[model samples]
Target: MSHGLSIGDLAARTGLAVSAIRFYETHDIIKPVRNAGGHRRYGRSDIRRLSFVMAAQKLGFSLSEIAPHLHRLPDHKAPTKADWTRISTKFRKDIDARIDALEELRDKLDGCIGCGCLSLKSCALYNPGDMKAAEGAGPRNLTAITT
Candidate 1:
């Protein structure tokens, strides 16, 4: 049987600030038991949950998005390898989409810089003929290249 831990023990184990752990509890990402004196009591699974939360945050997930996934993990059972794989697949797809968008923006900026066109309407890099500029769909100015 796993031993129950105090909030301070959980914080020490996870290397997270006590307040951050408390914040996660408040956000419903974790639920610790209340002791007789009302101090929070955590369990072994809290370690795994908080680890997942920190990892998700490092990958740029918002607290709201991470909360649901953390909550879905079985409380009494550790997450299966398949569960992690599934979650990673979704995160990978999101990362790929962001990379593709960034690459496209880089290419467009390169084209704009190469052509040295200053006018937004006349510049192929900015205009794209579909009137993306008129619709105000992209970067407002060519200054991005310099900065």
Candidate 2:
């Protein structure tokens, strides 16, 4: 049987600050057992949970977004392969959208950089529709560029 670990040990293992681990607990991402002295005691499975939390956060997933998936796994149990597959699919979709947007932006930048159009009115980066500037200027020449 795997014995529970102290909060300090968990922090050291995960390389996360004690407060961050506490924040995750407060968010209900990881629920550690409370000892008689009221000290938090995490189990071995917490190592995986904390790793997932850190990786998800680095990928720009909000706590609210990651909560449901993390909560699906019972305490002291690792998430199943199917659970990971589902999460991976969602993450892949998010990544694909970001990649598509970046590619479009790259194409637009390439076109604009090579065009040598310094004038904002003729610049494809600034104006894709070739919109003429109004007689009176506003605060910013806000032109919507549709990809």
Candidate 3:
């Protein structure tokens, strides 16, 4: 019999629902071993892995984006502080860029809200009707902020 936490134990410790932990496993975010009776067994390290997954999700990183970095750490082993620092650096630049974009969008929103007409020459100061419409259909200023 393997001495490890049960799935319920892991869910309790991580404050994640059992179904959510199972979902994470489906994505390869966590791997639990099966005991002799065919019950899943999880080590303490899975706690940290689940926590990292939650934090990455909170930062607006998708599961696909988070998977590669999680692959670098050994399974069933706790990651060292250095390992976390190294992996998190990749996110810092991207998160910072997103923050900057959102801030710029917020600033531009004030001017755009003043007028609903992109047809206005004055409205063209931020988004010219012909230039924006030529590219695609949507508020050009907001698209520019995101893209």
Candidate 4:
């Protein structure tokens, strides 16, 4: 019996479906080894890796965004607490920026619905005769966070 977890064990530990584990594998988020029997075998670290992936996805991070951080982790063995702390520090900054953006959008959302109603003075605060059209499409004021 070679030392390593089966794909099923990985999924069970992470509460992810077998298919979902495979999808993560394809993205190189979790690199499993093949045992002598040619079956997939995962390291214990994979549980934490998949758990991190699940949490990041819940926070609206794309696989592309999450991949780089995970890729930096050692593939053959468990990562140290320092390794996780370093990655988490980076993520903390990103999370803070996202929180700021969401707060800005929340605070300003009521001012302009971008429904082409320029009558309200609040509309002037944001769109101002659709000047945002020249800047680019989409909710310009909401996205920019100018105030």
Candidate 5:
């Protein structure tokens, strides 16, 4: 007998669509084995793995960012507490950086809104003469805080 849960069973346990599970598989977030009949079979550990992925995504982590951490774990086996502790240590650093950035943005946003200069090119605040445009596209002023 194949020693694992079917894709459908994994999806039900994780509250994820089977398609989403497949998506994570593509990113190396989970690796399911194939039964003799060629059906995908997920180990019980995949439940915790997918659960961790779900929580990480909720915290704004992209799959690319998460893949490296999970890849270090043993495939088809539950991660040890030490394994999770290491990952969380890294995540905490990222979370701290994001918090600092958010605080900076909050402090700056008030000043920008209060300045009452709707014109980007003429704003004396962060981007005088739209000089931030030289930095590249996307919310240049907001994202340029650390850059």
Candidate 6:
């Protein structure tokens, strides 16, 4: 009934549930116009926006992190390949940091196990006597990683 795509059309095109599409709208990740009948009408650009969100989530990004980048792009304009490339480049540093943090955790866990600290009275990770409490709370070795 209009130039915009229907909610169902968008769901079918993106392989997303209608409710998920609505949810994205609520989060400002996808913007839809209301038709004369008050039904949600999305643009072709919305598909690309949602697809980017999907890819970003798969890469371990929270909606919060992806939202700012999406906000920078035009809502009604379809992003070019180069546009996506430029937006995605910023994530590399975050990905690298996560990888490094995970590696550090693995190494620390290995060290703890190799030292037979798992069931010992003097455990580094288990903190059997609150020994690492002096260094502060929660996963002493991985304290460098944050939200």
Best-fitting candidate, measured by lDDT? Answer: 4
Error of 5 at 117 (Å): 6.4
Order the numbered candidates by TM-score, best leading: 4, 3, 5, 6, 2, 1
Q: Which stretches of candidate 6 lie over 4 Å from their true place?
A: 113-130, 145-147
lDDT of 1 at 40: 74
lDDT-based ranking = 4, 5, 3, 6, 2, 1
Regions more than 4 Å wrong, model 4: 113-121
Specify the poorest-scoring 10-residue window by lDDT in model 2. Answer: 138-147
Find the candidate with the highest TM-score and give its number: 4
Q: Name the regions of candidate 3 deviating beyond 4 angstroms.
A: 113-124
Task: List model 4 lDDT by residue over 87-132, tens digit each.
Answer: 9999998898889989888887778855456778888876678776
lDDT of 3 at 47: 92
- How many Å off is the CA of 17 in candidate 6? 1.9
**Who is ahead in TM-score, 4 or 5?**
4
- Measured with C-alpha atoms, the lDDT of residue 121 in candidate 5 is 40
Whole-model lDDT, candidate 5? Answer: 0.82
Better of 3 and 6 by lDDT: 3
Q: What is the TM-score of candidate 2?
A: 0.71
The lDDT for every candidate, in the order shown, is 0.71, 0.71, 0.81, 0.84, 0.82, 0.77
- TM accuracy, model 5: 0.80
lDDT of 6 at 24: 86
Q: Can you write out model 3's per-residue Cα lDDT over 1-147, one digit (the tens) per residue?
A: 248899999999999999999999998888888888999999898898889889889888899999888888878777899988988898897788889878877877667632346655567675554455665666666675567
Over the full model, what C-alpha lDDT does candidate 4 score relative to the true structure? 0.84
Model 2 segments more than 4 A misplaced: 110-147
How many times do residue backbones clash in model 4?
0
Candidate with more favorable, higher lDDT: 1 or 5: 5
Worst 10 residues of 6 by lDDT: 110-119
